[model samples]
Target: MSATPSWQAADGCVHTGPLLQSVNGFDVVACEACGFSHTLPLPTPQELEHIYSHEYYTQEKPLYIERYLEDKAWWDEVYAERYERLEAELPAGRRRLLDIGSGPGLFLAAGRERGWNVMGVEPSERASSYSREVLKLDVRSMFLNEETAPTLGQFDVVNLGEVLEHLPDPAGMLRLVHGLLAPGGMLVALVPNDFNPFQRVLNESMGVAPWWVAPPHHLNYFDTDTLPRLVQRCGFEVRHVETTFPIDLFLLMGHNYIGNDTLGRQAHAMRKTLEMNLRAGGETGRALKSRLHRAFAGLGLGREVLAFARKIDDSPSPA
Candidate 1:
């Protein structure tokens, strides 16, 4: 294999290896001028798959599944709010939606109720099986790539909520997804914003890796700066891109300050404290905090992002 040129990260400094995992003797260091993080020697697709498919990610802990199902009922109710905002301009005539990494089929379930033909591609047996059993979703146990690409027909909308960060080559994967879409189809993706304040506090002030910085599992960390470019490279023109992540910060702080051992007795205690913190914050305090967090996010301090786009007539035509 030939060595590739090191990426000059959004941060001005040049980095060469995986920023997330130190296992390959690859590490990330920051740029001085701007604060974008960069990793060394970008990972190959094979390395990325191994890390993602590692037991930690693919494992389906019953506790987590149960907790998410309980808490995510709200998301189920609120999901299409974004698409609804742009429904007038969203793909019309036909809508076949494909959700990559459709954990428990939340989006697909919601989309189905709203009249879109929906399917999901997930590698985890537990998650996909549960989606079929519980949501009655037509999800398949497949990973996105050349082999699976030809099987799924053209879709009207493809949504990848919080799924790109885990991939080895998001741009390449988007190419496959774009190919799966019919002309004028839309692609919506959500990615982590590395510049989120909580992450900044952990990395800059404390000099600790953001616990979210689990390497191998997450090979590509994106923010507003790199996202549009990545999507455009995959052959989609920007439609409407809005980046917001206050809720994610709340979750990240809970995980960091409260706890990480989700399987432990400590997690039980921490989760209670987290609930109390929200309750004490009060109904008004809660909304106020979310507003303030949004202000911070508007200033580009939030930890996650959502981008929406539509297929353009010209795609530089995929090979």
Candidate 2:
């Protein structure tokens, strides 16, 4: 591991609030100026490279790939809603998509099936190989940075699903994505909802720690308010923002399924079952679920925060 660097905010300030808590040996603090929470002693690029390349899927969570494949039906329903929104927002015939951190090409496969030209950039060799050999998709076995962006060309849609929270410098990543998008193109990002008020209440009620705040893996934390603001600050117009179902509701209602492996798995299975059943109910069920999702998002209590932004034709270059 590289030497631990001094604490700094996205704007380059060195001052920060007192330690919020320590997770996995890294100190967590809120930026005094921006009010965003992040892990102190940020992991170096080399460490992150090694983690994502060698140990991410295999060791970090051994069953991640298998479980991801097992939940395809549920994930497909989520992907379909995102793609439908993208199609409705953009004019017909605009189909090029670039999925950053595309794991096993699920989203890329979903896009391809919907008549879009899809490409992926993933750092995991195992994942890249699977995407190519199994799915026969176009994927680059590397990370997305300024150097690699030119090689991929511009894209009509840039998808960053579940990616922003892992970065040490998320603002820089967003600016880079801004450059890759074509004029009037859209960007869709999904990030975990951390340090949320509802989750805090649930944690207090259950007398348990905040299980979602993992360090090294999840370096940045953002809620519904801050996420869209961050995107707009990066030179994109915020178009839409929504949230996934808040599983914390079960905890608030006295379920307390966090530590019990069986209960946790059952909760996840229940979510998948509900989604699959609704999707099987045809258009009416789909529409009803969509409205329900919107309502949940409006309440600002969801497991994940989903936001969509567009690069305006006359927007200035990202700073």
lDDT of each: 0.64, 0.84
Where does candidate 2 stray beyond 4 Å? Answer: 1-6, 9-12
lDDT of 2 by residue, 1-319 (tens): 3232347644566845556667798877765544567788688888898889999988987877788898898888889989999999999878999999998999999999989999999998888899999999999999998898889998999999989999987888988888888888999999997777778786676566988888889988888887888888788898988888888777776777887868877888887888778878899988887788777777778899999999866666555
> Candidate 2, 138: how far from true, in Å?
0.4
Task: Name the lDDT value of residue 257 in candidate 1.
Answer: 40
Residue 79 accuracy (lDDT) in model 2: 94
Worst lDDT run of 10 residues, candidate 2, spans 1-10
Clashes of 1: 8
RMSD for each model, in Å, please?
6.4, 3.4
Candidate 1 residue-wise lDDT, 1-319, digit = tens: 2132255544354554323434345454342222334455456666666544445334634464676676574455347554563365664567688898887788788777778789999766777888999888998976789888789888888888777877645666788887888888888888888646666666677665566565555555677666776787678887655554343344444444434454333444444355345435766755564465446645666556767788886667553
Off by over 4 Å in 1: 1-24, 29-38, 41-44, 47-62, 206-208, 247-297
Clashing pairs in 1: 16-40, 16-41, 17-39, 17-40, 17-41, 20-215, 21-215, 193-303
